[model samples]
Target: MTVFRLPDLGEGLTEAEILEWKVAVGDVVTVDQAVVEVETAKAAVEVPVPIAGVVTELCAQAGSVVSVGEPLIAVGVAENSETARYREEEQAGSGNVLVGYGTSTAHRSRRRARPTAPPPHGRVPRVISPMVRRLAKEHGIDVAALTPSGPGAIVLRKDVEEAIAAAARPPETVDEVRVPLTGVRRTMADRVSRSRREIPDATTWVDADATRLVKLKRNIRNTDPDARVGMLALFARICVAGLRRFPELNAHVDAERHEIVQVKGVHLGFAAQTDRGLVVPVVRDAHRLTLAELATELARLTDEARAGRLSPADLTGGTFTLNNYGVFGVDGSTPIINHPEAAMLGVGRVSEKPWIHKGKVRSRQVTQLSFTFDHRVCDGGVAGGFLRFVADCVEHPEALVTHL
Candidate 1:
């Protein structure tokens, strides 16, 4: 019999809740065929079986949380057949964990520890590869200082050396009543804790006359239902322009290294509240996308996020963030900076308000724009300038043509 354990899905994840089983017992699975879907704190991921054989038993039922090294399935093997060959490969060779990746026997097995070394930073000195250990030793770096971006908190060499180079840096649970941090909520707590602890943040906000911008979106609203350019999309465009003006906010501080790290392109992350919880879905290269393109992507990602179908990649790699809290019927917010990124631009509700137009009192669509930034990156002068530029774009929508 060949046993398949819950393989480490990377990123120091400890356990995952099995959502569904793709196959039943007695069903045969080929190499790399997904047998189940498991939801981690990160995302709902489908787990694939490594070797091909008849399913002897399903150990864990749906909705049960299984630890990283616990048995997931049992497969019965036959000798003198194709299944036997696969079983041979499993025993003689490296066992595949994630789809398209394998864990070599040598990689999984541990070598004896050196006579003397630095004490473990965490609960235990994380099980890491010999090469990773050697690299840490050569550099005189603590393995514990190197955060684990690998499976079950094992430190990756890239994570360690990045310490050498520049260095760099949720689900929801519960219901109508009070709930506990089981899934996405727990994930967000850890992240927000890190963001608040490491970042020296500041906030600035201003109200803008968005009458022209509102009209522009309304005019183009029905032009293409597939690609609806709304207020958020326009604000996104303005943010792209703002980032161009103040590149400092587009950067992050390597706190350990005490150096500023500026990102290359703008992977714009927008906050979307879903049934699961608050999640940020990123649009890659927001600077290159047009208004319609940005709108389509926003709608697509928002829909996916709401449905809980967003992949881990869809939720990460944001160099800057654009948060539109106005949809919640609020006027302003002191947005918490999405960590690793230096700043977050928030937009409150755009509603009619009294304003002076041509020296006469009139009603205009005005909105509050708030910017929270890393004080380590720039001073109030730069933060103020970025927010003011956004306000200017809202007041004069025609400026977009020139800004673009």
Candidate 2:
């Protein structure tokens, strides 16, 4: 019997709440086949089996949270050359076998075992456990150079810890506080890192006279006292209009296929600060929704996010994002492009500012708008046009009527 641990469900998520099992004991499975659905703080993800075999055990039941490197399931397989290699991977915790969100892919075959030999003078040692790998990675230790004390020259956790201690023997030290990054925060960190690494992003900003937009909101509320229209919904409508004008910004690059995919409709996402963490709840088909409808949906999603009741579907598939950092009492931000999305528009706080209006200097309601775009999808011209259009609509709310 081989025990398979709950692999790190990307972004170094330490634990997941098991939602349901796709297989039970005695069920036959294939490599890379999803066997269970688990929920991390970020989203619901399906965990795949690393080795093909008959299920012998379901270690954790639904609604139970299992941490990384803990046994998830046990599979029974007949002894063979392939089984031996799979066992090696199971012991080593090869994370490549861990599938991505909601999908699985083919697993890479491991090399056949070589004759037993000592570690070469100038080679990295063999790492055989996830704990050791994580320990070394966290401490910036070169496992290859470490002298392993385990059998077959496998690097162990103690080896890594010892190396870390030796390197960190500081002459002067204070009590250090360590906070573990788990769940949503860890997932967010991973995505942000990937976005910065993969995206050639650029930002442009403009000061917009939001006096008309604010007045439009008041007029609508006056027309219908029960109308739920708010500043965020108005901004969502503006973003939808901007996307319709510049469809290029409503798309993502398919890095593997070497293609740019233009999304069909606007799935508008807005950043909301929730008790769990920061989450972007998507408003699907925002283009089809009326201003009032947009307000209603945004309000609903925000409530759901705050209550920590949002599901994975509520958080995925956003073609464009509208970030109102102004709610946090900030004036402006050069927002990061949400991974897989082409652009995001950030709104600063709307305040009374001195401005030239009707050819005269006056105090006007103004806000700064910052647009950040993935340069890979479009150049500065397209990004500039989208921001300019949004700003124009903000200055003259009636301009949206032409597009709506």
Say which candidate scores most in lDDT: 2
Q: Write the per-residue lDDT of candidate 1 for residues 1-404, one digit (tens) a residue.
A: 88878876677667776656777777776666667776665556777665666878889865467887788988776555655665576556434445444322222111221222234665444555555567678877788766766434446666667776653322356567778886666766777789999888999989899999988888787676666788889999999988988888888888789899998788999999998888889999999999889999999999999888999899888999899999999999999888889999999999999999889999999999999999999999999999888889899978878868
Judge candidate 1 against the unseen true structure and give its global Cα lDDT, from 0 to 1: 0.79
- lDDT digits (tens) for residues 1-404 of candidate 2: 88878765666667666655777777778777777876564555677775777788889865466888898999897787766876686577666534452223665223221223444785644544554566688889988888876544555556777899999997776789996778667766777789899999999999999998999999999998676898998999999998998999899999999999999899999999977788899999999999888999999999998987888899889999999999988999999888989899999999999999989999999999999999889998998899999999999999889999
CA-lDDT, candidates in order: 0.79, 0.81
Q: CA shift at 109, candidate 2, in angstroms?
A: 97
Query: Candidate 1: which stretches are off by over 4 Å?
Result: 1-178
Model 1 misses residue 382 by how many Å?
Answer: 0.7
Task: Give me the overall lDDT of model 2.
Answer: 0.81
> Lowest summed lDDT over 10 consecutive residues: which window, candidate 1?
105-114
Give candidates' CA RMSD values in order: 27.6, 29.4
